[model samples]
Target chain A: MEKVLQINNLSKNYGNIRAIEDVSFEVKKGEVYGLLGPNGSGKTTTLAVIMGILNANGGSYEWFEQPFSKLSRRRIGALIETPNFYPYLTLWENLKIVAKIKDADEKDINNALGIANLLKRKHTNFGHLSLGMKQRMSLASVLIGNPEVLVLDEPTNGLDPEGFAEVRNIILSQADAGKTIIIASHILDEVEKVCSHVAILKSGDLIANGRVGELLSAEETVYIQTQKPEDLIKSLKESDLAKEVYSSDDDVAVVLNTDLNSGDLNKFCFEKGFTLTKIQVRKQSLEDQFLQLVK
Target chain B: MKKLFNLEKIKALSYPPFKTLMIIHFLLFFLVILVVSRIHFSIPGFSVKGLYQFPNIWEFFPWVASWFNIFLTIVLITLVGNEFSFKTFRQNVIDGLDRNDLIKGKLILIFTIAVYTFIMVLIAVLIFGLIFGISLLF
Candidate 1:
């Protein structure tokens, strides 16, 4: 896939505080990329630098291989922080203003409202809407005009479960339609659920980044159920795939790297006259990997 | 710039309170003229010497418009402050608006306030001119 966004050696400082230090990463087109980090980990700062909201102390970035420009921004839509709208404006009216600002055709307003599920609430003032509704309305601003890229900061903020599901569905649909997404969120589960790729940030540094599956697969373990659990454990102890092997009840669990072969272990057990009942492969969750990396 | 202007105009019109207030102001200003004009015609031989004769009151339209502009300008300043006073500005950049677009968005907001107020003043001036013109012929 083509690289849609690239950041090289990006760094930013707020007074004496280093917000981001030597961060580099790439987000390919048609993928949901997550910027995962804790608060004060510089997630917001890095985004600000990319969006050109703050001048970076060092490094550079480009979108779609083109140097960042005003025109390029029009192709990107974003929701950062709380959605800003005139409080007295109805949901439809707020979106209409955003549509105009985005240079989208007037007819597209209804479509944007529809996608946000705010079509029925078109005449309700923005201030009076619930928090979740307000968030949807804000997202509607980004979803309008069919921008090529959607950069969302904590997209699910203030959303109830149903609203969150709606936002996730919209994001999935957008990804399916081949639009690029760059999402920054402190919520690990949300990132794990939506991102195809992820970049883990720590104290202004890019700690770990890769395909979500790859990152999550970093810590792999396998469980083997055998009749000769004792002998199976002894033989597996000598193998290099076994980082740590221990037997629990009828199953021998081995925490190992990705290269470990189940066939070799099965053969060894069979040769030793031990009946292997089952072999189960276990992959680490994104949250586990994230916590490990951050640690 | 024109695109920005239109965007600002639409945003300004979107706010119900702002829109409602403008409409209310228009009607009230109209009624003031209507009542005065009716009273002038109702009483036979009533000397209306100081009604429209106060030259200072003619300046009231511009004065009020200027004050409204100042009030909105204060609100604009607050709006600009709010951008930095909160996380939204930073979040916007992370979301890919870039610095140029951020500036453009803010500029559009200011222009909207300016233009919206300008139009309101223009309408008031036109109405006042009409009333004064009609009164002179009577």
Candidate 2:
């Protein structure tokens, strides 16, 4: 697969504060890559640096296998941090500005607005729109040039449930069209649903990176309820069926090995004279994985 | 270059403050020149009419226009300040403009404003100077 973006040991600092340190990752073509982290975890900083808005303190990044340049920027549509349109300009006018910069035809303005569902409000001033509408307008602007790569930071910020779903659909549709996307978001569900690969950042360091399912679902946790929880945990610990067994509030949480499943564990416990009252299998959610990684 | 200019044009022309400040700058320049032309000095040595004729009008019109350059400066400052306050400079780069292109776009805007003021003063100088000079013939 062709490499869309490659960052090698990228570092950035603000005065005395180090924003991101020795962080590195690569995004391949047609992959929806996610950058996930907590607040101030350098998600936005990383995006800003790669987008050429902020200079890195050390290291470098490349786009399309070449040094980042103006032409490379033209091939990527990006919206970082917030929707930064001219508040006074109408939605159509603001998108027109973006279209002009990308050397795109004026017809693209209407196409983008229609996609963002802001065509009815195209002539309305950006400042006058609701916060959710402003965000949608930002999405509209990002679609102006129909670039192959889209870099979006907190793309669903300030959106209602319906609007959030709408933006998610737009992103998924774009991905379906085979456009590679790089999104930096704190919303783990969004990343989980939208990204094929993810890089988890914690306090300016690249802690984890790989396929979302492999990285986040390496172990399946089974919540088992039994009359004798202590004996069940002890028996499971003695057996190789459970990787880690610990007590929850009233249930016992067991992380099973990769090759083991909940049925196998239940069978093992049944043979050991332990009757399971309730057994619920769950894959570790991205949120749970993210919290554990950042913690 | 044309792309940046078109981008800046859409940004500035649609802005109500930009248009309002530019109109005020234009009207104030002509207003000052017209108002100053009507001043009747009691002192015989200094006739206000002399200021509107030929070479004098050339100097007089530009000098009067210079006073309103502060308005132009404010307009320029407002436009540039907007990029920061709105963080649109960062967005513009993300949208495909180079960082240098931001400065270049503003430079083009500055040059365009300079040309507009020049023409306003030039036409004022020509019309006033020719009118006053022709009146002197009568």
Candidate 3:
């Protein structure tokens, strides 16, 4: 994978408050990277800095291993926080302005509106559209120019279930097309569902950064109940497959190794003559991971 | 330059406020010309007349036009302020417009208004000078 973006030792301050400090990360091509954090954790600020909307106080960032330049910007598209179209203009007219700014062909407007499912509403004024439509319009604007990379900040913010699904689908479709994507989202579930890699931030600090599978796989938690819980716990403790095994009142739980599955646990226990009564496997949700990481 | 101007024109064409401001500017232009050209229409309360006097017409037009500058200023502020208030200024940057693009867009708008006003004022002077200026040359 080629490095598409490298943000090194980035820091930003707002008159005294540290928005983000020493934030460093690399995004590779064709990777759906998520900058996951709660509100005020500097997700918007970081994206703003990367997009050159806000200047960073310290450190450096490069797109495609090259310094930031106007030509590089033309290769990228962004949908930051909110939809900011001209209220009095029709969606078509608003898109034309965006196309002009992006230096995209006017014909691309049709494709973008089509992707947003807003072809019929092209003539409708932006103010007249619903919030969901407004979001889709912004997404459509981002799609203009066939940009190679997309930076979306809180793509699902202030959206209903339907709107959320609509935006998510559009993002997924874009990702499927092999576009490098960097999404800033406070919602762990959204990041989990869409991102292949994630970087967790808390109080503007990077806590964890890795592949989504390794960062969040609830399969690590396994619950086992047997007629002979004591023997099973002791046996699993002796086995390398089980990292942390403990027995409670009625059941025993263990944090299994990533490579080891529940089937391996059952086989190991059965070979040791421990009859299993109940075995349930559960992976860790990003919410649980986030809580533990932040703590 | 032409491409950038076309972009500005596209935005102005769609924006309702831009059209409204233009209409108001034209209306005021004609209104000022009509009122300042009437030499003997001085009412009992007002005494100043023959405002478009020749050789001083350049100075006269701006004095009459200066009265409408406040309105034009308001229009300009609203036009520029709307970009920020609507957050489109940020959008432009996000859409691959360099930050410099913003300054250029504004300069274009300012000059566009200036050029439009100057042309209107020039036409007003020519008509007024021919009809009223020579006879009441100052």
The lDDT for every candidate, in the order shown, is 0.73, 0.89, 0.85
lDDT, candidate 1, A1-295, per-residue tens: 7888999999999999999999999988888999999888988788767776778999999988989876777788887656766665577766666665566776777887888888898888877988888788877788778888988888888678898888888888888888999999888888988999889999999998888887766667567897677777888788665776776457787767456566666666677687778888777677756765687
User: Least accurate stretch of 10 residues (summed lDDT) in model 1 chain A?
Assistant: A257-266
TM-score of chain B of each: 0.59, 0.95, 0.81
Task: Write model 3 residue lDDT over B1-138, tens digit each, in one string.
Answer: 665687677767677777777788778867867865564676775434445656577778867777777666877788788888999888888887777878898788779878888888888888877877456554
Candidate 2 — number of clashing residue pairs?
Answer: 0
Candidate that beats the other on lDDT, 1 or 2, i.e. the better one = 2
Task: Assess each model's interface with DockQ, reporting 2 decimals per model.
Answer: 0.25, 0.82, 0.65
Compared with the true structure, what per-residue lDDT tens digits does model 2 show for residues B1-138? 887888888888987888888899899988888898888764677789999988888888888889889888998899999999999998888887777889999999999999999999999999999999999999
* Range of the 10 consecutive residues with the lowest summed lDDT in candidate 3 chain A: A214-223
Per-residue C-alpha lDDT of model 2 across residues A178-285, encoded as one tens digit per residue: 999999998888899999999999889999999998976785789999999999999888988877788867989898887888889889988999888999987878
The root-mean-square deviation over C-alpha atoms between each candidate and the true structure, in angstroms, is 6.6, 2.6, 4.4
Q: After superposition, which runs of candidate 2 have C-alpha atoms over 4 Å from their true positions?
A: A225-248, A262-279
Worst 10 residues of 3 chain B by lDDT: B45-54
True-vs-predicted CA distance for residue B69, candidate 2, Å: 1.8
By the DockQ metric, which is better: model 1 or model 2? 2
Top lDDT prediction, candidate number = 2
Give the worst 10-residue stretch by lDDT in candidate 2 chain B.
B37-46
